[model samples]
Target: MRLIFIIVVATSLMPISAAPAQAAPLDVKGGYYHFIGDEGGDVDVTAQAAVLRNMEALTQYRSIADGSTFPGWQKEWINNLGPGVDRNFVLELNYYGAGEPTIPRPQTVDGVVVPAPDMTIQQRPGDTWKWAYGYRQVTSGQVDPLLKRALDQLKTMPYAETVNIQLGSEFDTDHEFGTTENGIAHGWAASDARALTAVQYIIGYFRSHGLPAGVTFSIGMGGWHRASFRRMHPEWLRGDVQVLQWNAYNHGTPRTPYQVFNRTRAWAIEDLPRWRTKEVVIAEWGTTANVGNQAVWIAGAGAAIKRINTDGRGFRIGTLTYYDNDPNWGELMDRDAGLEALRSVYTARPFIG
Candidate 1:
């Protein structure tokens, strides 16, 4: 049987008059995993189903970043599988380098090399390989056109209800196409004015076009200050936007977990109050723990959930979507055991009681 778990705030923490079931589920926490590839040529239906079955939410770039075959294929996938999944489907728009090369590249349209100013592709020799193979550029402006294209494609899809247009992810990283010099020229670089402007433009575009309701911007889990972005636009610092959406991959540092948790709490409790009223979303989080140390990782995760849930300051986090069977993060699942463990945590009622 499918397991369903609910979390309720304690009686002392909430008003006596409030209904016990009124407490909200932990807000926007979820997992980031690769579900589509190569224009959906080799679709992994089974694996995709397994992930959706296990996760509360998922973030995907199939229709945005790579459009060659993904747009049609993803639409099909969502149509076939989205009905049964109870989680949210956060669709990312390519506002970073994911769109650069595709943006109206100057090419021979009619067998004659003509300078198409409308075609804005400025190809660097290594950019394509870097994007496809490395996946490292953290900030890239090439995404603007790509985002427009993705939105257009989404309008044609059959499963609009299963979609949430996420403006961008991990804008603070250096590897992002938006942070580069080219990205800066395209208007995705790190000025508070520029970032805010871009956000407003995206929001305005979505609203004007009548996009779905679940659309929103997703900042990474990296502490706001640690984000390379803060170095460029320090004035945007507000106390209300909690930045805890990225992963805390341990690189063998003994104190990494402790430090990570502390930083997350500090931002949720302190930094967020100064910004807009936004809740924290651990949009992506996982540790690269080997099989021998899985217990330690699990314990650490449990502790994190307990601490965040029980904090008296009312800075409550919404969700804790652990990384499931990703190979990049040391492949948490050797077989199906990791799924079993995840099911246990997701269904357990320890936090509610």
Candidate 2:
């Protein structure tokens, strides 16, 4: 049966604790938008602020990995935007070896460098190192104090009501350095053992501290790896943990927009059944092709969003935060068509009351 429910923007919905029933229809009119750039500092900041001024939520990636550099002007924008702006501010934290400080050292099993106890292969070059250290530290529930300090800083911010802390992204992808079997020789596992431990600790910390009503823990979606890994290990399927945030982009290969959309949507749908408890959010979704196809990507993504929301049975599809025009990934908003399509959705449904 098709479930036709309201798409309430997270900013608008009452706290999950208070709203036992399903959320009211989501007002997609003004959800979050991001500005991701490695450089081009102030110019990028101004442009981002202009766009987000009209949005209901805004999430910014200050640094790629765990590095300490935040956009100098981001604080200014947040401060000036004020609480009345109604935009939720989210800081993307790549705790699992993807970003900063890098993982301390590799894991050793039986005197040989072995994959960490509970992690998958690494997708990026240095990712293995990060996973190895993160797994060792996080799994033992040893990273609580550090995480608490970081979360505490974020919580004190004025507009930090809704926070999306993305733990290890694409835990299933073999491309990541630490998740691969060969990388495992260097110390990292394919099971996310350490990350999960860290996540539990984070949830408890937030709850105990009473940060806010909407603070949540989101696990990055393992899009491509879901089907591939399931085939390899049928017994590994456990329907306990919720795979929250997903990172999807429309690029690579010769696939048409429709084909890309189908492939992307399939990834989420297949994993929904395995996730019995938590909700899903397309935390990061966009197209990286040149400026021309931006509109096509947005349109295709919007259709996919509609489909997922309507038919997402066991999982509740939460937010679809689009990627912005930037260096690492091509600009998503350069094309007027793409911007218009996104704006239409954002304005059609206002996320906040």
Candidate 3:
């Protein structure tokens, strides 16, 4: 999503928490995301600089269209890196066929391999098509081959020591043809069921197939998604999916770094069951150039992140990733204030796994 650049602007900065002693620093990482297939404007050189500055987590969104070959474009720059770059890799994997019908190998339930469901594609209004499973179509068996493809590809890459797989992008605010079709579910209830089932299968599949030690799987959503849609079934937070991902963008509304932090924390942490915990990662975050003071805003955001990480709550945040624009939007690196501020945040503290 693009953050429109309007002339109206605001700026505010709240007190950042004092840094803890060096003996006990916060456990958070600074990172940046390169949009899929963006090759212009020194993108690779800029990304290399981010890593050299200790922004040790890098992500790229990969939307695999149905019947397309698995992507190896990451290797274009990754293979050229010098020794000891030491960065964790992440891929926000989105399959265009996520909501399509599938009859993969017979599904196993309670130790019995049952015949797969007999499903057919159904045509909906506006010439749209959905699988027989209806709105909730991200089934494990249907997406298994894609997942396998990802693991197999990653195994052959470098700097993929710690990998994170975000199943799909923000479905809560998803739309098609100007309508509110999430492509995953019609309502929150169905969303919960289908999401949980798909994740559980993912966890099991990863366990059986060895990849890396610190690999994590997550569910991604827009930070503005309603609390009802953010429900965390105890089943999701336990030993299954280890992370929750959200895109954090104020669109000039919250108007301050602290407000942005609180808004995101509420959705990523407070909205869930208090007893359960999972790593929260801001899969994408940014400020429009025309918005408030980008430097102060980013500094305050970094400070707020430090405050949250040191709060003794089990809300272990993984990464605060800046959203460098995709091919369609303006790049964050093009904004001097935003880029410098992110570099300042990354250099201020060390990130731990």
Top candidate by lDDT:
3
Show the lowest summed lDDT stretch of 10 residues, model 2.
63-72
Instruction: Summarize candidate 1's per-residue lDDT along 47-151 as a digit string, tens digits.
Output: 644643444454444323444322344345545555433222334333222345345233232243322122111234365412211111212333345445556
How accurate locally, in lDDT, is each candidate? 0.42, 0.45, 0.52
Q: Is candidate 2 or candidate 3 better by TM-score?
A: 3
Candidate 3 per-residue lDDT, tens place, 1-353, comes to 13333312211232235333342335577766554342342145445465437665555555332222222443466445443333333332332232333322233333544332222222234664422221223353544555466667666655554556765565444322121223423445544455456556666766788765666676656666555345533543566666766777756554665566557566545556552366677777776656655566676666667666666665556676777774222245355666777777777753532
Give the C-alpha miss distance for residue 260 in model 2, angstroms.
Answer: 4.9
**Order of all candidates by lDDT, from best down to worst?**
3, 2, 1
* Model 3, runs deviating above 4 Å: 1-27, 36-52, 64-71, 79-140, 175-185, 232-237, 267-270, 273-277, 326-334, 350-353
Worst 10 residues of 3 by lDDT: 6-15
User: Which candidate wins on TM-score?
Assistant: 3
TM-score of each: 0.61, 0.62, 0.67
RMSD of 3: 11.4
